[model samples]
Target: MLDHEVNRFNGIEIEAAHAPEDPECFAGELAAALAAWEEAGRELVWLRVPIERAALIPVATAAGFRFHHSQEDYVMLVRRLRPDALVPHYATHYIGAGGVVLNSRGELLVVSERHRRSARPYYKLPGGALHPGEHLVDAVIREVREETGVHARFEALVCFRHWHGYRYGKSDIYFICRLTALSDEIIRDEREIEECLWMP
Candidate 1:
């Protein structure tokens, strides 16, 4: 185990144990290291665990570490050792984009999903998941067009919400973008979207 003390960031970066050793022993080592860090006044610690080394997950979880986020290659685990930590921990972060579109007639655009896992259908803003490597603005525009079949111009970032234990057991960052409809024509993906309407 190696510690990269990032004093400037007010945190320490710890690498997951990768010596091909017993997991129980490593768990104890990790716990001890965490204690040492806390004693040293370190405020935060981050551990990057590759997907293949999933065995280490139990070790970190047992040590009170929480999930932060995950990429295609690895999962990020975080622990807040002290209350004054500068950065907040959000494990497995997901980004979703939606558009709050208004037409010239002062009507709002809304959509209903054709099929969902929930008990009943829910109408919401026309939007969906952002594509990998896609910009937030671009994602919202694309999602709006796909779901509502309307071309819209993004005006501003209206708001966002942080959801814990969201869909698929992942933390979600939901973006509500303000938009102005460029065209009144409404088109929607019939397979995924059941309805699109202009509401007051």
Candidate 2:
């Protein structure tokens, strides 16, 4: 058993245990630790385990803990945390940010910028350059509002594509996918945006 204290917001003591040999012994120890933390007014209990030991999930669930899907090295199972948890700043660089917005009828929203002057004039997702110290979600929301003249709420990061020596030097293009049901009352401000259409 490992004992530690975390004093980020509310000071709470922590005790963690791991089982490299016997799974049955570790399960009992983990359950005891969780109960002790709860008695001490702790709100969260974290457990890290290998993906191969997925059987621990059932034990954690039985102990009132939930498993969160992650794309990291180890699987993270946690007990109750705060409801209003602040999102951490994880992205280091923001080369470019954009997302696909789908309406209620599963139609994709595309935009035509007034600044683009080309022969074909093809359309693209509604997003632009990311400002310094700006999060991807905030940058995308500002870009959609500026280019499409409509308010949007960011959903999640879908996929990311990296492009080198394109137009703006070496950059990482993130295709953030968001689901939004557009209302019929769209008030278009035609200064930066040429047109906004919902395409099926």
Candidate 3:
């Protein structure tokens, strides 16, 4: 078992604990330490536990803590020090390059990449690379409009996957799913896009 203290961006002090061998035992200790921190005027307590060793979840819930979000190697849970006056901080990260999946009815909108000389043709979603200093959402909207000629609004973040190859410079990629209303109007730009259509 190990413990550490850290400060959040909102100035709240957090106490975190981890146990490699016995998660149940560490959960009890973590609850106790969190109570102590709360008594000392800390605003919240953060916890990290492996998804496989999820026995700590019940203990934390019994101690009034709730699950937050999980990313990479950490799963964070928190208990608010000020129950009625809690305000969460929103931190946005650019999702590198962005692409959109437009689901209309039961079909997905896709674009056909034109064959250059003797190269093979390929199919892909309508989106493109992000410009410098552009947010992921804004970049996605711009790319979709530029490629497909349809205005769009962001609905939800569905899934992300990486694309790796020599042509793309072996960079990590992010595929974003967005829901937008469909229209019959077609806007085609010859330079960057070849053709667009809806397919199952």
Best by TM-score: 1
Alpha-carbon runs more than 4 Å astray in model 3: 1-105, 115-118, 163-170
| lDDT of candidate 2 over 126-189, digit per residue (tens) | 8877887787788887787667765667787888787665653434666565847444234544
Better of 2 and 3 by lDDT: 2
Task: Report each candidate's C-alpha RMSD, comma-separated, in the order given.
Answer: 5.3, 15.7, 13.7
Candidate 3, 55-91: lDDT as tens digits: 6667767877777766675567777876663646433
What ranges in model 2 sit over 4 Å off?
A: 1-94, 182-184
Model 2 C-alpha lDDT versus the unseen true structure: 0.64
TM-score of each: 0.57, 0.47, 0.44
Overall lDDT per candidate, in order of appearance: 0.83, 0.64, 0.63
- Over 7-39, each residue of candidate 1 has an lDDT whose tens digit, in order, gives 577788865645345678777777778788889
Candidate No. with top lDDT:
1
Q: How good is model 1 by TM-score?
A: 0.57
Q: Distance from true position, residue 132, model 3, in Å?
A: 0.6
Preferred candidate (lDDT higher): 1 or 2 = 1
List pairs with backbone clashes in candidate 1. Answer: 67-91, 68-90, 68-91, 68-92, 69-92
**Ten-residue region with minimum lDDT total, candidate 1:** 14-23
